[model samples]
Target: MKTVLLLVTLGGLLVLSLVGGLFVWWGMGGVDISLHGMIALTLGCLLSLLLGGGLMFLVFYSSRKGHDDEHHRGPEI
Candidate 1:
């Protein structure tokens, strides 16, 4: 069940990304912007993933670093 859910979630994201790409392609056709559209779309998706992943990493890293710092503090006399 968990695997099925994961697959469905990933599939939904792929479909949405493709739909976004199509919108960009059609919306900017007047200026021969297909290449630009694709680049922009790819960058946008990459940025989104990077930002989201970075935030998650930052949270966990800060928490774990603080944890280790406290653990390493000298024992009270």
Candidate 2:
């Protein structure tokens, strides 16, 4: 029951956010982008995703390989 309630609440919040975003977008005139602008947006989004994923991958890799543990130790003389 708790899990179901939590999911429903979260889903409602997501829908509300989307509706609010669309309303703001509509108020902003909703202008169409040129092909070049669209391509730039797509590439920018892809590169951002790639960079974020690569950094997260490094985080996990370093953690598993114990590199993260080194930070917890006092500096050696």
Candidate 3:
């Protein structure tokens, strides 16, 4: 039952993403993109992915190593 539900959910998401992508592509038919623009867009996406993945990895790694433990603070005057 769980497997069937998971499969159905995934299938629905796949269909939705395909339809959304098609609509977006059709809507951008009038836009003219240069080679440099395409290169910049690709590099931006790659760098953003790398930065986000690095931050997430650091968070998970610190958490697993107990670096996120609470610290005792002295009373303020």
Candidate 4:
């Protein structure tokens, strides 16, 4: 059941992104944007996703390793 739900959610997002991309391309018809600017934007977006995913992976990894478990630290001196 969980797997099915995840697949459905992912499929919806895939469809939404495809539609959004088409809309953006259609809206920006014939706009002369610099090649360098487009390359920079694409690289920046890719780097941001990499960093965000790495951070999330570290968080989940730590949690699985019990790093998130609470420990009682007795009265502060």
Against the true structure, whose lDDT is highest? 2
Error of 3 at 56 (Å): 0.5
Residue lDDT tens for model 1, 1-77: 99999999999999999999789868886756488897997899899999999999987997877975786689889
Worst 10-residue lDDT window for candidate 3 reads 67-76
lDDT of 2 by residue, 1-77 (tens): 99999999999999999999879868889598899998998899899999999999999999999998989999889
TM-score of each: 0.46, 0.61, 0.65, 0.70
Judging by lDDT, tell me the better candidate of 1 and 4.
Answer: 4
lDDT of 1 at 43: 100
lDDT of 3 by residue, 44-66 (tens): 98999999999999999988887
The residue ranges of model 4 lying beyond 4 angstroms of the native Cα positions read 28-30, 70-77
lDDT of 1 at 53: 100
In order, how many clashes per candidate? 0, 0, 0, 0
Give the per-residue lDDT of model 4 (tens digit) for 2-64.
999999999999999999998998899797769998999899999999999999999999888
Model 3 misplaced regions, further than 4 Å: 1-19, 70-77
TM-score, candidate 3, is 0.65
Query: How accurate locally, in lDDT, is each candidate?
Result: 0.88, 0.94, 0.90, 0.90
lDDT measured at residue 57 in model 4 versus the true structure, 0 to 100:
100
In model 1, the Cα lDDT at residue 10 comes to 100
lDDT of 4: 0.90
